[model samples]
Target chain A: MASGILLIPGPIVISENVQKALGTPSVSHTSPEFVDLFASTLQKTRQLFQAGESAQPLIVAGSGTLGWDMAASNLIEPGAKVLVLSTGFFSDSFAECLQTYGAHVDKLTAPLGGVVPLSDIRKTLGGQKYEMIVITHVDTSTAVLSDVKSISEVVKNVSPDTLITVDGVCSIGCEEFAFDAWGIDYALSASQKAIGCPPGLSISVLSSRAIEVALNRKSQSSFFASFKKWIPIMQNYEQSKAAYFATPAVQLVNALNVSIGEILEQGLEARIAKHHATSDWFKNKLRTEKGLKLVSSNQRVSAHGLTAVYVKKPAEAISALKKKGIIIAGGIHKDIKGEYIRVGHMGESACNDSLCHIQLCYEALSELEL
Target chain B: MASGILLIPGPIVISENVQKALGTPSVSHTSPEFVDLFASTLQKTRQLFQAGESAQPLIVAGSGTLGWDMAASNLIEPGAKVLVLSTGFFSDSFAECLQTYGAHVDKLTAPLGGVVPLSDIRKTLGGQKYEMIVITHVDTSTAVLSDVKSISEVVKNVSPDTLITVDGVCSIGCEEFAFDAWGIDYALSASQKAIGCPPGLSISVLSSRAIEVALNRKSQSSFFASFKKWIPIMQNYEQSKAAYFATPAVQLVNALNVSIGEILEQGLEARIAKHHATSDWFKNKLRTEKGLKLVSSNQRVSAHGLTAVYVKKPAEAISALKKKGIIIAGGIHKDIKGEYIRVGHMGESACNDSLCHIQLCYEALSELEL
Candidate 1:
């Protein structure tokens, strides 16, 4: 009964209306009701990506990690070399996924608490035989936002043929971006993050070029990962026909539909701006407080999601906070786990005040006498 | 709101209690409430599999088709030959998926509405090399259940080393089977089917040997499809921890938890018996009325699921029925769309009296002069 503030990054707290939408009477997956649901959800996802007529948005049933696999499988062919600009934990996973898909992945590694080195990637692209470039924007693990825009510019200048993709799982609605204007070929995010839906669906928006490559990539993409299966399903999706495959997670889709409705109705610009303001306020609060330090020392910080604050006896502080019904997350990735704690500022938690959660962490840690 | 019987195949209608469970106020995926929800749902799933003391169930976030990928990726190595006994639409999809996972697949194909020739599969096994075998019990696309017991017996005798896996997506709680007793290494089903939740989470039970294979075959299984990732995460899941590696579709998990409660309380045996009775009653009505003929003439019909009826102007009959507020379904993978209509009899619809649905269908079709 005592559900405290979800100040850890995604899956952030979902709204009450969204939760009510999920409880809507269970419907057949193939029933006319679900097609309308899928259609509406798909359209909302496309709007988030700013996808034009040439692009298509795909909703696959899985976690955000699966989105990386879907992107790798569709865009890259066996033996193709890809450049993975690793800013944090997520890009590392994306690199491993690329390797699994038979791509020779080259990682341009950056420190966990730092940004992608655009110049270094440019040099690598200048000399390498890579066919694709992948960037992770706002790696949820370390709270580091990569410079996807700068990296894209450099990569396009050096290797124009390279596919430009971003693992935007931790960013999206919370972050400001122009997908079409920036020429992003593929952008992937999950419902759990700034989208404010409980996780289970990974949404991917693909440019015309990415679709062309997917269609041309010799063999069919892994069946579950295939956009082709969803393409016609969405095209013919009307109230009367049965869904093409098995029924989808109808309740989750409904939750997403409601969340997206709130997002667009309020306007994305206002939402993203509010997230930045809330993050700025939350970070300022953490900064003014005693005993906590920002992991990323530079002013250039992740604008719209979680923040990492280094603390002494970090595990004890997290444990004590959990005991008080205010659960903050521990640092992720092999690089930063023991030294810092994460405070999520995304979705409902982003706009709503989590001052009590931040205050609870401080008070609990003080009791530990650390 | 005239909510008639949802006498359609999966995703069948879930109980009102289960549907209402989705209203349990949304929580962040990493919220303690959600972790407890996931852990509880999983325990219930394990009870269903009766996955002995040593075996485990890996709950995945995706369609049941993803199950074929999970089974193949974990068991079949690159170039690992596998045998598929294809009976219907889903079986072929499994074979195709195995092929994607780098297996040399040989299929013993059965005609539509038919089960594979067990003798032919034994013959194929004796001549071929395989690491695993794929079989489907009660193909949703055909309303036909293959003889899993007979097939497993033949595989055990002729090819003991090969793992036998069953796709019980349409059969799980609707019929009875012992994963261990039948020599099955893996059994997979979707929550949207007999378990009667909604679509998108896939539930699979692994034999102890299967888990060992999964752990040992890390070199082969794609990361997303690996049971290793699933095991540690689930093992650590508890009532108090926030489980947030990926977004988990929290509300759906809650709905499934509620569905599982109803299932266990209702008793698995009772549920399956209800399905059997309803399917029998429905089939009898179709046969005696001369309004339609069974498309699946095989003696071994799926005991507790659907009855695909052959009727003139099947599409018109289905459309007409839809207009009359009594919704049903049609046959799949038969190379033609309108020759047959599949009337589902599982989950909430399993206990349904066929008299009303039949009468309504007759009225609707007669009005259309079909």
Candidate 2:
């Protein structure tokens, strides 16, 4: 069972406490204790999002892609227009998912290393009415971060009726996101990423307006992804009543409860600041010492959880890091798939001092011939 | 952390080995070692299903209900005709899920404690062509076991083109089912049931014909549940290549691999027989020794994994058992919701004599003043 340090963008190195929670004996999904745990976990997720009283949180058994499916299936009816702000691979995938459920999607793509400009978004909004607008807060593929707050502001000013959804899969816990303040209608994330839990659950916070649209949808294209069926279930669980639409992943939900509790104990602001500082330090070290160029053109739009860096012989560099007991990822962006590598600096690896994962990555890269 | 013996139908008592696997260090989904594990696990799942080489096994991160959604979204196109053979609550729910995806569903429901007659199925098939026929192998609500093999045979004889889908969530590892021999097009189950793993993954085996239907569909009704999108990814993983459509539930998959390995070690036939023997012993003790009635009318129709016994005071009896360090489930079938209780005997609890789970249930029931 010997393993190297995990530096992938998600399925990050979980804390021992969280792992213990995952190992807890299986419990019935309808048990009173599990209902309380589930309810508390949902409430803590709201705290993580900094959502208001009108927002509802859902924890479903699936990966982050399920979160995208939830938004597409629940909020948008068939043939409804959706504006997808494509920052990278994930955003484009979101648009594709929307299309799968019969939505007429219009994607506004950004350049390879940037997000769409606010003026372009405004112009797009003015041209036609949209049912929803999706923005990826941090695209894991390219490590590009979008200005969600500014985009939310512009959308609210120009098209207030359009729902605002943020794909926070790679950003939620590590990055600063104010669900209430930014006026986001839905923020979807997974347990694996910066949440510091194992992969399994798709967590999302939905505003009351989003729930309203879901409830009033003319036709539902999916069953498992429908928010209307799940909202009451979630609400009932949060009220300490056992309700079932489906049997949840008991172990993963327990792990999430423990992990979110840890996040709150450390304070969300401090955790985000820690990620920001560690990311800056690691990116700077790579630049100054290894002469590696990041895929992100500027620091302003770079993700704080992971850095995608261009390097010669990306595969060789990754192998060398693996040899040094560190596991980093190769680039995933289609155009530069072989030209860069990615090093994640989130969760326990970013917040704790034991691993010094940043230094390990730098040392591993320096020893490599690339 | 002192817990009682879990006798509920699902999320049942997990083995120590599987729980230990759940606490394994998180690994990257694309890691070569994980890829090997994933491939081996998928192959082992085929062995569990007794499926042939042509059948494809998929392990997705979701509950059993997601399996229904996957079947509906992938196999049944919008406005397509489907025949739903309803045994109990879960079967009706499956019909609802199919209709949500725009399927024209015609449901033939069995009586409270009985299964749909094979003659009725044959008559229905003779009337019109159906795109698919869904059978819940063992309805969890009433513990009623449908004769899936006979049903499949009737479907094949009457309308060979119609796909035969079995909801094996409550029966897969405990019941005797031969996917290839029975001509089952799709068999779907969950991790937490008889598989002895925690809940999260939706496990299924699809015949080559089912795969073809999914690939050649004019349009995918759902994104995450799309077989066309996932087939390649699943195949690539089984080929030991790192492919990603969505981040997997790495730890749970690892746990499943371990649990399935244990099942193989015990031998599937032996495990099934053990469940059958223990179920017979428990049911006989409840009926002859305690004068309790079962919701399932006869032994031939009773599920091997769980028993639904009718009691005058179901809730009080369940609470009384709980107070004496036992956990059982109240009835869920609408006709006898408050009249029966369920006790499960499956997985390690059924196969091994160490826990004496069945004996414990009998002792607990004997202590109850029913």
Model 1, C-alpha of A68: deviation from truth (Å)? 0.7
Using all chains and alpha carbons, the TM-scores for the candidates as numbered come to 0.93, 0.99
Best by TM-score: 2
Candidate 1 C-alpha lDDT tens digits along B1-370: 1225455676666777777776665465655566777777778887786566566776777878778878877776878888887767888888888887778888887776677777788888899768898888887777777888888999889989999889988888887767878888999988887787877788888888888888887574466776767766766674356544455666667777887777778888787787777777667766675656665655465545777777777778776777666677877765745688777666665543444554455445446543
The count of backbone overlaps in candidate 1 is 5
Could you give candidate 2's fraction of true interface contacts? Answer: 0.76
DockQ of every model listed?
Answer: 0.52, 0.77
Poorest 10 consecutive residues of model 1 chain A by lDDT?
A238-247
Model 2 lDDT per residue over B241-291, tens place:
999999889999999999999998999999899899999999999989999
lDDT of 2 at B238: 91
TM-score of 1: 0.93
**Global lDDT of each model?**
0.74, 0.91
- What TM-score does prediction 2 earn? 0.99
Distance from true location, Cα of A305 in model 1, Å: 1.2
